[model samples]
Target: MIILKYIFKFYIPCILLITAVTVVLCVRKPYKKQTVNRVVFNERYFRKISGTEKEKYLDSIVTSLNDERNDSVSRDLYLKAGEEYYYLNNIRKSFTSSQIALNLSREAKDSSRIAKSLYFIGDCYENSQKDSAYYYYLQAQKIYTLINDYEKLGRMHFNKAYVLFYDGNFVECEIELTKGLNYLKNSDNEKLLYSCNTLMGNCLEKLFMYEQALKYHQYALGNLKEMKKNNLDSDEVNNFNVSSVINICNLYDLKGEYSKSIKELNAVLTKDLKKKWPRLYANVLSNLAYSKMKNKEYKNVEFMFLESLRIVDSLDYRSDAIYKKIYLGEFYLAQKDTLMSLKTLKEAYRSAVEMKNTNEILRTLRLLTKIDNRKKVFYANRYIDMIDSINSIRSKISNKYARIEYETITVEDENKILTKKNFYILIFSFAAFLILLSIFGFVYLKYKNKELKFVKQQQNDSDEIYQLLSEQNEIINKAKEEEKNKIARELHDGVMNKLYGVRMNLGFFNTKLDDKSIEKRKEYILELQNIENEIRTISHDLSRDSFLEGSDFNTLLSNLIANQKGLSRARFKYIIEENFDWEQVQNIYKINVYRIIQEAVLNIHKYSRALNAEVKIQLSEDKILKLSILDDGIGFDINTVKKGIGLSNIKERANSLKGNLDILSGIGKGTEIIVMFDITR
Candidate 1:
């Protein structure tokens, strides 16, 4: 009555608006861009429609939109039509419409629509062909993941898990169900959550985790109970509630709590389960009887089992009948009727083998092997072969699932470019051209200002370095002046005195041509050689290279390390290659190199906390001047390290010389800063 009232309430208003909407739609453009979201003139109103008349109405709109003339509009309409058809239980048309939508979406290269289409198609295939359903679900899942559509992604997971559960891949089913719960827990997907939790419980029960399975089943029951009647059908909720009770009862029985199992089972028996769902009615009867037998409440247990078996057989549920038979076999064996138990079990085993039910077959085989000693070896061999085959099948299925589920998808990055037909517009758009030109000019000027500011700052840093170098040069010039004066004094005091004595001796030898005078002349020549040696030493000092090369460069590096070694606890090592000729480089390049090394050493001393440091300067035969500063200390993450003046100066100097600089560091991994200046550059 309520559903009829709802339909009447909505139908009259829609009937009143039909003519007006049709007139407007006929006059208006049917396939505009925004019309896709709207899908049809009355799409928003039909979103919750459930009546057969509304379904026909939606089908008519889809048929009329066969020549919509817009790819995206057609795709959207088809996808919406697919959804509507699905809710109306039109499986064939739903699959066909969704397939059309997928083709159109792919033609337009629409990723989200393609995923949506696949989801509907998978839903259509879920019952008919489970493997095909899983394949589509996996494809849809990857696309949903790529698009970050979590709700749909979670739905896909539950769908795939449902397939795996039915296929008896319980462990993998449990894994997927857990993931589904995580994704849907905070969402308004109570129904899917209930279903996945139920399956997860079933998986745990199959895995022999009785307590855990009981917890999940309870959680599923809670979800169903807490859900609103409008969100979930009352009858459906009642069905799930009774199903949860049956599961809980079985689990309790398995855990050796038969009293609790019987109590819960009795609670749901008041529902009209026998008439509404005879299958579940049979299951409850079977579970209750089994629990009673286990609890030693043997009265009426056999009658209850026979009644459940009668219902199962009437329904033609082979698996359920076989299970009831096995339960009867166990009951008879407990009552010491060995012949009847063996006969009942053999019947179960024969049917299970015929049906290819591995779980039941194993159950039957185990009991037969335990009691039927004459055929024990045969049952044992069959059980072993079955176990081996199951193992092999499970291994292959797991590998196949991994390959399908974990495969990476590469989405296209291509964009559809609109064809340019307005050739005159580009030529005649003088105002737009001016606007673009103005934007370019503004950007260029702004960039130029930043560049000028950076250059000015660099120049200032270079000036500071130049001033320091100049001060050092002044001190060296002063020392050179002092040395020159000392050399002049040495010439006047030592060399001139020796020369005067030699001249006097020579003059004496000129006056007397005797043998004693000749001996004195030989002594005068020896004194001249000594004065020549003193003059050569002073000239060598005057002619020493002032440019930073060889010993000069070595002196600079030593002084830098010597200066920093006291401020830091770092033990410094400087390695200078033997064939490195610094004179081939110019003063400006050499100055930058010196400043780079100096700043790097200063930074290391301040922040490196290094126990050992190495400064290696080498020049390869190809004229690549390499400077490396290494330290064994706590390093820094380059992405996070704040560049201070010392490091900045090193970078600026290296940049000025057109060098490639690399500062490699990691926390506790030490730091290595390398700069290589290509002399060719």
Candidate 2:
């Protein structure tokens, strides 16, 4: 055993060293191989390839990437591969790469990358799984909006609109396309603008607005021309131009301008549309043949129709093929071949039914009924069933689309909540805490500034009211001083002289000491009593104009009611709480309260036509001031009688005082304006 241990101890270190070296070489060998082929595997060189080769190379690159990485580079690499795969018509692989990218972007919390990843995933599902594609596009749209990426957001809108168009919801498709254009208005992306315009033109054509459709198609061609100046892909620009031309020609055909349609189609066909876009080329040919057939020029029309059908069938475009068959059936009917027309219409009807295209099926059934009279009842019933099913299908599609949007919005809300929570947690970090502190300080300052502004405005209003009242008080004071001087003169010139004369008469009576003198003294005493009565009358006159030394409202409010009584025949009365001190009220509160009472009294005088009016003011123990202005006049219906400026001013003053006002009135019921305020607050 010792011999075996010694041998292990000596050779184990050598074995361990050699094994570690071997493992290191094995681990790095793939990396070295990657370096040698970096020109091919590298993302930096990805732009060097195209078509099927590029898609295959992207798949290989994705397979070779380290699965453990969750970084921006890896995320971007996966996103690029996914987009390339989608362009190459490999949606399954595209979806896989986009999903990985999405996961990595989420882990990294990268909003822009996440949006781009979701957009690619949406693109992958756009052709087959429209609802899913719409949902993903909506999610991406939300992210783009949050990040303020208008270009991508506009693209998402158009993609979603295309999905709606595919479902035959032309109205909604037009609406979304319009919104997409608004977002792309400021974008320099001419290609996407061209796409949006072309789709918009198609929508208008479907709605049968031929003239407006032509205008949009013209706009689309204009976009294509601008795109060409930008050095956009020649093939892409050609495709867009062809699409616009075809749409314009279709509109012309709808307008019964078949020669115009044929001319446009022939013009676009010269751009080698067949080699570039086979489906659009077939579409152009089909429209050209239809236009020729409609214009009564049947030269090579059947051959062109057959050629278009051959391309569509080879491409397995079932909807296009169905439409072509229906057109051919119409041609046969024009030729008076009723048997062939009925057979063709029947075949088109079956194809449309298999495709679940309700409108086309109804149209084909209608055509079949016209030709095959023996089966008219059958076709009619089938047509009604299809019409009913169409409503159901539209309802189902609407619900499905709405549900998808709802789910996307719900998930976005949840993600926002989670992101906010993460942000809150991040606030605990030192730098974040500092940032938060600065933000708090700024917010606090803003709030304080607003409060200060409000307070300053209130102060200005109070000053204006105070200045006004001061002017009123000056007038009152001047009148009071003049009245006081007049009363002083009356006392001095009238009462004092009479009293002096009475005293002199009394003295003269004292001088006489006989019977005649006694009669004179009685006369003199009677004259003195007359002088006393005159003095008392002058004192009463003085008291009417001036307030008492300690009294305030015995004159101010009473004087208000008294003056209003002169304007209206209404007998005015007022009440003030015994404990309330007018001097202790804040100016803002005091002036508003004064103005409110003034306004209410004026309103009653002018409008109420009441025989009696009362102003009651009370202050509770907790400093709550309650005021009521009541009138017993022919009352108005509050709802019927709109509040005039007087009532509005009263309410505004009450609000300025931070008080609640309730005006209760009904026909034949006296109006009562009740106001309450917490003065201490």
Candidate 3:
């Protein structure tokens, strides 16, 4: 199936080109429009213009392009403007101009320009600006499909793979990357092929498909070799060669072939490419050092790691430098150099924490655990804490994906019902045609039969639609119960375990307290007590009993506000009207409301830069809960700001609860969120 897809993808462009030729041959007069003078200026002029001058230049171009008298010229101008803005990293402006270009191209029915604009839009979205990156990539994918532009289609799929990865959907990412490779299989575009294979290998590795990943990396290497053979000495080709080599080395390291890995790294180094590519060199050195460390060549590993560290430090790049430090610490730990290992591992651990490298931190913590018995307890506790936190996050991501799938299936079922209904309508029309032919044989009899058939068909259609709706509702109910269980498990297994362990640790220390040591023990006890308090705060609100009883709504809100008050400097103003009938609320609806408010308040406190905020919950007479959350802050335009997981969570939860949520905010204006949901007794 996959090979067939590749073949079809390759042939689609040729078919499209033939169709284009046929259209052009059949058509007589082609419309001609005036070319815009604005298209003559390049990105260099925009770069030369400073501050307000640059803004003025852009503004004049936009105004001139907006002139209704110059539609074709306007489109060309917009495309040029978009290119300039894209170069400047002004993604918002670039996206706007590209969208304008797309609109114009669509209006003109120009397939080539439409494809080009879509490609630019995809590029803009894939860059730093985050809003609807996936959406834009998907849009570009559809446009490329229409134009049968396989190269752009492959690029779009690759970008979608990245989005899936960031969303923690590694399985989906690997699948999408495979689709990308299939789309580009027969293409002569060596750069695109290399990129697709490398990314596929990376995602496969992340998914723990080591053998498959190595195969893809090797495939990429083969392409690079072919490109070289073709006499294309592009820097891009060189970069791909180096990357494929590194991926191959890493795969070997994972496979426990440390010796072979070192050989691959050495080969890259022998190419004299180290000086020209410091980052890659540093990474290669770090990997080679790790391989040596595993092979028990302590002295050699030390020197190699130090070189990598020095290079990374000089280049001011800490990503690989942190890895080198951790490896060096591991080497010292293995040698039983306790003092040096402790100091080195501690620094490495700090760097890992600062860099947010969970894997490195986990490794360093394990090293710390194997050191002196005195600090072994602390290190062991930290290791367990990190593991639990990771597990909790994994569980959360799984639950989110599961919910997304459930909702998707529900939509499919609903669409199926609509399709079935249309089918029945078509059948009814065919029956009417038969009746018209048989009208002479039986006039009133034919009419009676037709009416009966129509009535029966309507009943069947209604039954099917009703059945689908019921099934959808059942799926949603099951998902809610599962989600509730997952949340409970996270609370009990994660936060509760840490709190218990810390308290137990403090209890053990309490027995050995001397006069001076008593203060230190008490300090540790205080820290543990604070952690316990936080757990209790979260537990009290997240409790299954209160949620099931539906009496915990007010308590949950109060706890959140109190927690925020304790954690932040901003004053929190929370208001709940007396009309709130907690006892009558449904558990799922209550939980959804609580989570939405929790996410919203956290975002406001963390990112709003607000001094004050207000939250209001009111039970309306229509058996609905109306929540109005407001914040007086340096707000953002919802239309422009990219919605992340937290905001997505709020929206998703609201959808799951069959509620409506509207967000109103602009630059300097405060944010006001209104959520309304029916909650019947």
List of clashing residue pairs for candidate 3: none
TM-score of 1: 0.50
lDDT of 1 at 158: 90
In candidate 2, clashing pairs total 0
Q: After superposition, how far is residue 183 of candidate 2 from its true place, in Å?
A: 1.8
CA deviation > 4 Å runs, candidate 2:
1-56, 271-279, 311-319, 354-359, 399-403, 406-681
Clash count (model 1, backbone only) = 0
Lowest lDDT 10-mer window, candidate 1?
Answer: 410-419
Error of 2 at 100 (Å): 1.3
Write model 2 residue lDDT over 1-681, tens digit each, in one string: 685456445644554465456546754634222222221246566667767677778867887665335556677778878887877888899899999999889977899999998998888888889888888898899899999998988999999999989888888889889889999999888878888888888888887676777888898888888988889889878877777777787788877788888888898875467886889989988889999999998898888888999999999999999999998899999889999898888989989988988778889988987789899979978876877887888887876777787777788789998986765454334234344424444344457768997999999999999999999999999999988866764554345544554565566568668998798678668867866766676666654323223556436667656545334568888888776687666555654565567777666766788989998888875577888899998789876788876677667667756688899998888899999888875
In terms of TM-score, the best-performing candidate is 2
Model 2: per-residue Cα lDDT at residue 533:
68
lDDT of 3 by residue, 76-162 (tens): 778877876777778888889999899889877877677768767867866564335665666567778888888878888888787
TM-score of each: 0.50, 0.54, 0.51
- Number of backbone collisions per candidate: 0, 0, 0
lDDT of 2: 0.78
